[model samples]
Target: MPSYKLTYFDGRALGEPIRMILTYMGLEFEDNRIDMESWTALQKEIKWGRIPVLEIDGKEMYQSRAIMRYLAKQAKLAGDNDWEAYEIDCAAGTVGDLIDLYRSMWKLSDEKTKEEWEKKLLDEFIPSFMKNWDEQAKNTGFLANGKLSWADLYLHGWVETLEVLMGKEIVNEYPNLKLGREKVHATPGIKEWLAKRPKTVY
Candidate 1:
């Protein structure tokens, strides 16, 4: 196997899912955590000035989704064929949209502003995407293609992150989504990673 080193901030954020993917594949890689202070100086060295960069055999690659897709293929977490992969990608894209909207809510400081964002989150965003995912998950134990794919891992990690941010078990409202996520959590290496990985707010 080629040498792998993942560099990111000292929190879960975008980096955790990558870590989970690597761990799930049982690939031994250096988990390099850098502090915000150091990130300033190190930012110059990062190709995109964004992290979760995976260094493979000393060559660097960027983008979280790209890295996950490449690694998922290696781990057999991708779908069985092209159409299945496309379907999985679509599902993962939907979740990514939700995550961006959710993150925007954090920027609001006022109670009124936060409440408005929360309203949009619960009343609009959650109902649409979560309902769709829940329906699919009800029929299949995973999020996409009726099988465990990288999309399932992406959704599971983001759902757990949302729970931490919202300070409640929000996904429980969608039982199938919750159940599907539980299944992902129970995957062999993932379960151990969840148990032993560093705890972070993001």
Candidate 2:
């Protein structure tokens, strides 16, 4: 088998897209999750002082987003032309914002703080993205290139992580977003991968 290794914590964080890509591709590799104590020690040992690194064929690649883009090309999910690739970039950037919003839950202590964050994200940020993606989806179900693209699955996996983190009913406001998510998640290869894959969280 082609050797690959992914290092991350339990939560989706930076490695979720990588995991989804691997699973969808049906590639077998090593998955390494670090405990708090070990995470701290390993921070000093790793080249970038970060987790969520991907080692493929013995070649180490850091930065989760970049790694995903590289592997997406290998998986033949990258778009056809530069214009199509631009859509992938935008979609990935948009998803990055959503994931950042989800991370806001970490330091929040009070229900008020959490609620405020959720309101801003769900009411404001998320709605804007929902509209944008809805328009995009109307043009083509895929994020771009009108086919299975990296951004398509990445956005799908991003929202899936959100649904798990936020709740299934959380996305009811955006039916198109929900439908788009379903289209990607229900893809033959992706659905099968999701079925047997590890359930790290919601």
Candidate 3:
């Protein structure tokens, strides 16, 4: 087995999905959580100076989605075939769009601008994505392929983050998405991981 070591801050954000994928694959790995001080010190040696870097057999890999996609294939969770993989990618990309929007909204300095962004997110972007995802999830209670895939896991992580940012349970408004998330949460390995994983505020 390849030795896996994941280096990230002591938070979920981008790192948790990678951890989830590893756990779901029944793979044991080093969870290297670092603080800002440690990250600053290590930044020079890290590719692209980013967290959530996964060291596989001591070879460093960067980019969270790339890592997740690679590991998903290892776990047999990517998809069954080329078309299914493409569908999964589409679903994952949609999730990525929401994440990027949230991050952009989060970085605003002006209170008015922040509030405007929040309003747009809460009233428009989130609802639109949630509605679409809820519709898509209705087919299988999973993001794609009518079965559990990495896209479902990606959606699970982002929904949690969205709930935190919105300060409420947003998924409840979309039953299919809610059911899909629950399905992901209830997976044997993931259920165990969720029970034992560190409680980070995100």
Q: For this target, which candidate reaches the highest TM-score against the unseen true structure?
A: 3
Most lDDT-accurate candidate:
3
* Candidate ranking (lDDT, best to worst): 3, 1, 2
What lDDT does model 2 reach?
0.75
The residue pairs found clashing in candidate 2 are 164-202
lDDT of 3 by residue, 1-202 (tens): 8899999998877888888898999889999999889988899988798878999999999988888899899899989999999999999999989989998976899999999999999999999998988888885788787898999888886578678868978998888887888888899888999999988886
Question: How many pairs collide in each candidate, listed in order?
Answer: 0, 1, 0
Q: What is the TM-score of each candidate against the true structure?
A: 0.90, 0.83, 0.94
TM-score quality measure for candidate 3? 0.94
lDDT for each residue of candidate 1 in 102-157, tens digit (9 for 90 to 100): 98887988989999999888788878988899888876668887889988888887
**Where does candidate 3 stray beyond 4 Å?**
none
Instruction: Give lDDT per model, in order.
Output: 0.85, 0.75, 0.88
Give the poorly placed runs of model 1, Cα more than 4 Å off.
106-115
**Model 1: what TM-score?**
0.90
Error of 1 at 168 (Å): 2.4
Which has the higher TM-score value, candidate number 1 or candidate number 3? Answer: 3
Name the lDDT value of residue 19 in candidate 3.
Answer: 85
